[model samples]
Target: MMKSFFKVIFLLALTTSTKAQELRFGLQPIQYVSETQGPYVDFFSTLDASTIAFEMDADSIWHARFKVALSFEGKVDVVRFEYTSEDSASSAPLMLQKSTFTFDDTKEIEKRPLEIFLYDEVSNSDWSFSDTLEYVASDFWLSQPVLLDDVEEVPVNYVKRGVSVVPVASLGLPVFENESTLSMYTEGFVASGKYILQYKLTDAYGNIIPGTSGFARCNTGSTPVYNKIDFSSQKSGQYEYSIVMLDSTGQAVAERISPFYWYNDKADEAAWNGPEVSVTRAVFENGWGQWSQVNEYLRMIAPVATMSERRIMTNLKDSEDTARIASFIVNFWTDKNAMDPLGEWKGYLVVVDKVDQEFGSRTVPGYRSQMGRVFLQYGAPSLVEERSFDGRNYPYQVWQYDQLKSSSTPVQQNQVFIFVDQELIGRQYTLIHSSALGEVKDHKWQYHLTRHTNAGPDIDATSTQYSRDNFGERISNSIIIGNQGTWFDRF
Candidate 1:
């Protein structure tokens, strides 16, 4: 039995140029083991929008016609999609497409030849990028590490899951010319499991570079990999970055190693280790002001702190050694900005203050609330659409992010979070649904939103958003009256 899941995404500002006879593309294949459905492979592919020639139709609407075919073992499956760009095709950079293949054998490891072909209808150009699915399954699954290069020095500011990848086309990898840091992304799967994740950078001869190795405790289906190393001292050479996952018993269960070539033509680019400042007790004393403030600030950064940092914070919660505390603080932010510890600290402080002022209440500081923690940890949403009580169902708000990035995960674009005010009194918006990976997700979120009104999980979809009689303002378009419910700006 085989199944295919197809998804398409378009971008407005993805502008690029290409010749008429070229169909620039790339493919990234990821494998996973589903608890119920067994094993599956997902193929994520992208095309340079410049390679796509969009034509204005009779109605003045611009459309791009294209088809992708996947073949294996003499069997072929083609997916045809009509992509719409309106008037932004010229500036659009990449068009993302996805397809999934499931295995009926449920084998832990399956190796098969897979061929991908893309045909450009506008230019009559076609290209083939063939790959194989060599999957190995264990108690957990670790995907190939994808290296994303910002050749233009412009951060895309948005990411679709499994979409950031290097191409096999002529664009080629950057010369390490503009980027100060490189981002490597990967995915993992476990049925509610935890593992120790480690990343390392090694030279051509396999020597581990100093300060290029770190580990963190990751827990999730797609566990977030967050590690940083010093890239300043790196000389021009071939390097391999490895991702190792260890079980609870400290045994290496699975590892993905990828080799890459790094030629830093612009090694002279200005390095930013932050403004240098002497580390001393005065640095701690005057920076945080009072001893009480030092302790308070230490307690405040728990949401973004790593497991090791959290442990240190646990031990430092009591000690009165302002100098040691200051040193710890400096070392912590130095990971973010070597010398400018105050830079990261001060910026985070601003976010904390905003969270407190907005989400805090008379009894509970905003940071402790669900909405406030999300704001602090995710750095606020792109928009918050608040829905007040309609006298039938609970009041809920939808928090949407144009792009959401965590200290552990890469940027996730078009992410959404939904919170419900169960009691409908205290304004404590509890998180009920989120599309962000590793976050809580409830498929029956609509049922929960109206469950207080006698709706059950098995209720039909139509009734979940409306009254029992199926009449009243649809949940999709409910407007808050008097224009005074949720008054906070998106900031």
Candidate 2:
């Protein structure tokens, strides 16, 4: 039995000013392996080799006698040609018929005169045609997210037209250039099982936009399944797409999600640039406080700035004068840090970068995140308590500040901020409650932490007071809810 396992062929279409042609011969990655098995004792001599073949088809006829044997040492020796033209109307003798072109090495043949020329001696005697060819190796490789060993798989029901689907393998669809399509390869499954392909798109804020979920049944008869996800009709914006897998019995087995960003280059260019800024000589020389631009630094610091300072920034925007913005930054920092103005501003930039790395979101940078705002306003939290998502509730976090400080001015102490990932995906946590005044607050903070529980307020009381029994600590059950009651609320 002749068995072949690995091969990938990509059909590329090229269009010129006058005509369109299809390219079918150049294989992607341009590598093929052919093998032949031998008896158990003949392992050393069992044939395992590779070769390249090309065929020319025109006028509804096919011909294929060209073979280029690839050496085991990764080089080409010669190209054997054995093609004959069947056009009887042309009495032209094939010029390079039955020819063998020897090469010193692969590099020499790829760069030299390998173009074949034939003459139609009967029809056109001296009307000569020329052909030239040159070859160069490609350095392209496919891109995908790095899968770590400890990465957890999230299984999602494949949704299509509000219906559920099951599949064997899933690929998280990614944003593609408008002219391109998303391509992926999947393998490792018990043969003869059925599968399906599903995709869902969500906007920057995690809202499932209407008319986005779609699916298609996949033909899994071949090994190493190849797929293409098209996006010719999707709009330009940031989105999240997921792929879910189901078995032959229509049960979800695995899933993966990835981000997609499509830039809208055709939008109003001027509107995108926004307002420009102007700074003083001292400030400009200090690298405009190390932000990408002076205006960006102004925008980032807005959350932590005082009302009066925010007014100045608002005025600077209306003026559209870079000089005024520059002056405001210098005077603002100088007034805040008269002795070491430059050093103080540079130090703040460090905090901004750290916040961005830790709390940034798809639509908002870290410096603009809810946690980021508090960090810049009150400094680092004195204590941070994190609880991973346990499928009972959303991933929730707690931040406690020993003292609330603004620009080094002490405000309040023993303050706390609570954030919850209500969606359980996307990782963008919302501040649901806090102990600080003027912030969103609710006395029942623990209730929100276990929002998915049926035990309600009493379960919140036991969990908050740490008085729940050993069994209660392990799982959330209806029996625990009835027994625990609200006894701990007295404390």
Most TM-score-accurate candidate: 1
Residues 202-234, candidate 1: write the lDDT tens digits: 764457878778886766545655433446445
Error of 2 at 488 (Å): 36
Q: Each candidate: RMSD to true structure?
A: 23.3, 27.1
Which window of 10 residues has the lowest lDDT sum in candidate 1? 479-488
Off by over 4 Å in 1: 1-283, 306-324, 456-491
Q: How many clashes does each candidate structure show, in the order listed?
A: 7, 6
In candidate 1, residue 391 scores what lDDT? Answer: 75
The lDDT values for all models are 0.59, 0.42
lDDT of 2 by residue, 378-446 (tens): 788888877777756567778887877553122566877778888776557877666553355444455
TM, every model: 0.41, 0.35
After the best TM-score superposition of candidate 1, give how far the Cα of residue 429 lies from its true spot, in angstroms. 1.9
